[model samples]
Target: MTDRTDETDDTHRPGDQPEQHRVTDGGVTAAPGREGAIPEEDTNVTEVFPEGNLDLRAGADNCYKCTTCDTSCPVAEVDEEFPGPKFQGPEQWRLKRKEDADIDGSIMSCSNCMRCDSACPSDVPLSQMHNEARGEYVDDQMDALSTEYVRNRILSNYRTSAELASKVPQLANFAMNFGPARWVMEKVLGVTKEREFPEFAEQTFREWWRERGGAHVQSSEKRIAYFHGCYSNYNTPEVAKAMVRVFEHFGYEILVPPQKCSGTPMFANGMLDDARRDAETNVENLASAIADGADVIASCTSCSLSLRQEYPELFDIDGVEDVSDNTFEAVEYLRIYEDLEGELADAELDGQSFGYHGPCHARNQGLHRQAVELFRDVDGVRVEDVGDSCSGISGTYGWKEEKYDTSMKIGEEMFEHMKHAEGEAGMTECPTCAMQMEHGTGYDIYHPLELLEDALVD
Candidate 1:
């Protein structure tokens, strides 16, 4: 509601300045404690002040707002509370995160979708804004609820995954049983009872890559390492496999090098410290790969977006900084296929009609049209674009029992769109959105590649 577009739109209550924020008790501005030295970060009594108008200046230099921004927004339509990044980034953040609220919750429900940036008419670098906001919050000690959740999930998933992997011989096969497993997690670990979490794959995408003799391509002219993120790494190895297939189809060798997370989840959830740790690990692991003529291609939208942008923010490690720019999402990478003649793999469902649900993170990376073009090239693929909007599943935010009804409610319109489409599946590039579509609408969801891979020659 608060528009920061106008330079003169600022309305500060009498006493606040750039130095210290004023606390208001009801209508009256409360005086500072004893020392009126308009506080700084070092002194802390938890001061409160109205947010300043933040101008992400995203309108021009931002990731152009595309239809996908609206499509992937979790609360765009249903909740009058949010008007999308156009509203939040330039308007709310101008004053709040820039001036008042902590960075973490300042952009609550954003889910780091970055879809807005993807769909931005002007291609605003929205992912950058959100990441920067979050970093600011962490530096300023922003709200830690999301960060707390992220920390717990990381530890919880790691431990639980190890335990589950211990019980199941093939982890990938066992991941299919996440339904019952998630229920158990609800009662035991208190991971929001309703949220759906992906089960860890028995074999990592990297492991699968090696088994497929991916290592033998050491001498290939085209070598692109795929950082499959945690979801694709542990649960949806199929997506990575599909990407590998596509890469091979183009005569490119796909590498599954040793790497940790991109740190978007950690930063978004307030695990600034933890996020830094993950970023550092990735930088160290990818050192050889990036330096050795390897290009990074990724399938997980969130992971791709994170590695391309957020990693530098978390640690500023020289290794990641050198190559993050070279990373590309599956869709981004596939565009090159378009530049050259390409064939569809999952062409079996080529004519099968479906709607495209871009994830916020993927949107941020600006890949909807590229993805749309990829499927459109297929004989049976017909994509009806849902345009800009959130899918209401802000990654794991939609997984909590308390957030279940709300998450689905936020995505109700998109759900209906998928339901009425008469398509064989609800297609999205995000794993979390796939989970949301299935859980929210009881519809089978497929990554665009899955639809194509099923049509493969082999």
Candidate 2:
């Protein structure tokens, strides 16, 4: 096993280059040491702004320093280095405009759970600011071609990795579990040895959809385009099947459109440019579905958040606004259509129970307990709200070597709750949360849709 310590790389700063420091993206300056000081005119820089040219200063003006965001932060609960969302968000926003405001390294610890955005009585987009600040911080600390940069770039492209892994799952899983392979990853890629990797499905959801006569399937006017995310499509195709069955059972035509990763991983990892590009692509792809009278739906809360919220808030994209209006979280969509609950009421779960782990992002969307409520409607099914808790696996954050321990620590309470719950299985909207729950508690986890599908009375 690798020797682990609580040490952080904060102290490793290059020699002072005050003259060379130049503010680039209105956030942070470049890294400390370089060959020669590059002039601003010589650099081909284009700062990507959010749609509506979102005024960060205007949003920052809403802060009254109530400490509400700080108190509500899940990351701050685990890591003290993170001074809380208030500091990283509005407070920093106010500070950054000052003539002499240093880049706060502590903001890097934020998982971007977005709980602070909900916690704010003033409704400050604190988490959004922190996310942008993180991108800037990453830009300031590392060069584009640095080892960490390359590693992050690869990790951010999880869809590509998943595609390859799904093609040869056994070999991929073996490579991940093998000691020497893990050692190489820890040493070279900065992924931790102890972290359990999610297994890839033998067949992708898209492949399964095609085999099941997806193109031939016809239905009523009610239609939905499923955004299965990377996990449901590649890691857990069964969830995708369950979602389709449940949707079809409720009398909706399911459209499985060609989709890409929602760029949550890229945003979380500070790859803003790539994330923006992904947002642009996804929004454009979703357009045809939206135009065909199909509302876009996603089972994964993070993916839904990206499609319905993040793209509009964090990236300048044309179709994002339209997509946001038409997009829905799977359960949230079902919750709105009360007749679906009536259909679920007839489903026989036979005393089946689930300890529902409401993901932070799902809660951030304000549809709290939608999954639990959906499960509760089934006959003989007992659903316990395991309390709103951060699963600590904020996309790729928990996969990194340095952040692994903190991730596990943040998840300890939720894991303990699952361990003691009456349910035999765990339920959650976010796939990464499911991965963390299964790893932490050694219990089989299911997407709420899977439970719903299983409960369906033929």
Candidate 3:
């Protein structure tokens, strides 16, 4: 396991880097990511800032030290060394990566948990910023490996979850019992092990959409082409169905466009190239939605986070790539159209208590808080704002043994909160957090939207 520790303390020296700290025993495996990759100046570099991604840079600069971001971060909660986005970026990556150097490798630890985005006081959108910063580290080869790995290693031979279960007992109940498997994957692969990955559902949302003839696209009115992120599309088809139902209640039409993975889960794994290619495909398909003036609404928080945030940074590196701009978190899109109650609306109280975990991408988008409010509006929803940032899952960061203990240690605050919360169950808008919370507390969790979909008045 890599001797990874959080290093973003307030007093971090300007010259410090993740690589700088890896020298304790006089020798270490020569830092894997940066050694072979040579920084070559190409059209891609020029594309990164065509007319220039000035707005992206400018947007990153906006922040006030409310510590809301630092305060709420799940990773920061555990790893005090990670100085939150406000510190890591505008403070670190943006300044360092531009040196045309290897600074991009240093941010590999972000985990993409996004607790800071939820807690940020200013409009920094730190979640998106760090995502972009991470994108800068990508190259084509990285993408190829993940595709090769998932296709060749896991998906092909591992015929069913049951087969995967033989290696890791938790994989048998992957949707629920993924923590231990993820823990092992992290130890061996450097991937975060804490994430509650979506089970490859017996049926997918796309298959369901096909059964319904790919839900008609209502071009005339303001519409949404809901991009069911990985989990919603695969394991949690009900989440996608529920979202469609939620939108339908308002007479909004949904077009199940031919979209695949948003690549965020892969991206979090540092499989940048695969993520970039996935971004390219998504951008092209989504252009039709943008052309129709429809906002690309997504229920999977990470996908929405990637589309609105990472796609632009990674795929648009040459500056000319066209990813649709009009994207919204499912809740963000629904919030504007539907009025939420001040308290839990129709949530089944039947002696039920609830814990609310916010997703990082949603938090960064300023929708995490709204998600909490949405649950609060539910009649029987008992909301405990656990207030921790990333849930230490950092997507799959918690799963890696190298970062495993740290990730769990990082998740301690939320673990304590969830343990103390008087809830019958836990719910998070972010899928990754739901997985992490479940592992930490052994409490069943659901996305708030599924709950909303069930409770909505037709």
Candidate 4:
């Protein structure tokens, strides 16, 4: 089995000379020694701020020091050492652009959750500024071989790690569970031993789909392309299966198109160049599917957000807008494009109650109520909105050794909410949120589709 921590030559120095990088297929690529580095000129800040003449500083000027972003930040509420998004985002962004100032190291604490964006009255693009600043900081300040660098690289490339481990899942699980191995990982990779690693599935979703001859299904007029993301593909195929089963029962033909990770991990870990690559690849593939008369849907809220929002905001790529326009959160797609509420009206939940935790990404996309509304008219089924609280595990953010305490601290309210919620189980559209909630509270948490699948009548 490949060692998860073994460093490959994937580091990219985007701060290097522009001559060392070349534009290929609408993305910047670095020279041999600095592979995957995107040039500074190709940063693509214009996509988000078309009125700013391609300058991110214009957005920063909108902030009037309101502190709404500061108050909305979950990390600021928990970690005093970390400054709020107002400081890390717009405040520093102005200085960084005008004076060429270094990004405050606190920028890493922003978590890309977009709560600040949602809260800002002035509509400042705080998260986008922080993301760009993080990439700049990493390229300028971080040593390529340092512990932080290597650890983040490993975490950001989770798709590769998961793929390799899934090939030999028993051995991988044993190694993960083994105390000594975890100690070594803690010492070397800086992954906290306090939290258990998410185990790889014995069979990947793609593999299972292929084996079941799902790829051979006949095409239908109402066709959809599925982007299962890495979590559903590797850690929990059941989520993807439930989505597939539910969609198939609704008379839609599903296409599991080729896809990379949605790049949320990379964006969080300051691996923007790799993220750009993923965005490019996914946009190209999904766009082709869209052209062939299929709308894209993702069960993971983060994945859907990436497809529908992040790709267009972060990259100046072709067909991204079209891809974004067609992409939908699985539940949101069903609620909008299908008669989901009517179909589920006759479906029975048999006195089941669930606490629905709207994930940050889902709320960012403004589709947080889709899942709750689906069960509104169903008899004997009560789904409560347990408040919009950050789960503190922003994708891989909670798994790092240094952030574990802050992560738990930020999550305490959410954990408390679930413990006292009027349900035997909880439902969320985010995989990491589900993981963090289960770890924080003892209750089982599931994707909303999983419960809906069980409740669907023949």
Clashes of each: 58, 0, 46, 0
Give model 3's TM-score versus the native structure.
0.68
**Residue 260 shift from truth in candidate 1, angstroms:** 0.8
- Order of models, best lDDT first: 4, 2, 1, 3
- What are the per-residue Cα lDDT tens digits for candidate 4 across 121-174? 877777777787788878888899999999998999999989899999999988
Best by TM-score: 4
Highest lDDT against the true fold, candidate: 4
For model 3, the local distance difference test gives 0.61
Candidate 4: clashing pairs of residues: none
Each model's TM-score, in the order given?
Answer: 0.70, 0.85, 0.68, 0.86
- Of the candidates numbered 1 and 4, which has the greater lDDT value? 4
Candidate order by TM-score, decreasing, is 4, 2, 1, 3
Candidate 1 lDDT at 59 equals: 42
The local lDDT score (0 to 100) that residue 324 gets in candidate 1 is 73
List per-prediction Cα lDDT, in the order shown.
Answer: 0.61, 0.79, 0.61, 0.82
Off-target runs (Cα >4 Å) in candidate 2 are 1-54, 100-102
Off by over 4 Å in 4: 1-54, 215-220
Candidate 2, 1-458: lDDT as tens digits:
01112233332332333555644443367765666766645768443332223357646766888998888877788787778888888777667665356668877678888888778776677767877887876777767786677777888999988888888999998887888888899899888888777877788889988888893447657889899898888889998888888877778888888778898888777878878877777888898889988899999989988887778777767777889889998878877874667777667866877788988988878776887767765678888887777889887888888889999998998988887888778888888888898889888888888877887625
**Root-mean-square deviation per candidate:** 9.5, 12.1, 12.6, 12.7
Segments of candidate 3 deviating more than 4 angstroms:
1-77, 80-101, 114-198, 216-219, 266-270, 317-325, 340-351, 375-378
**lDDT string, candidate 3, 305-324, tens digits:** 67766666545543213343
lDDT: worst 10-residue window of model 4: 1-10
Clashing pairs in 2: none
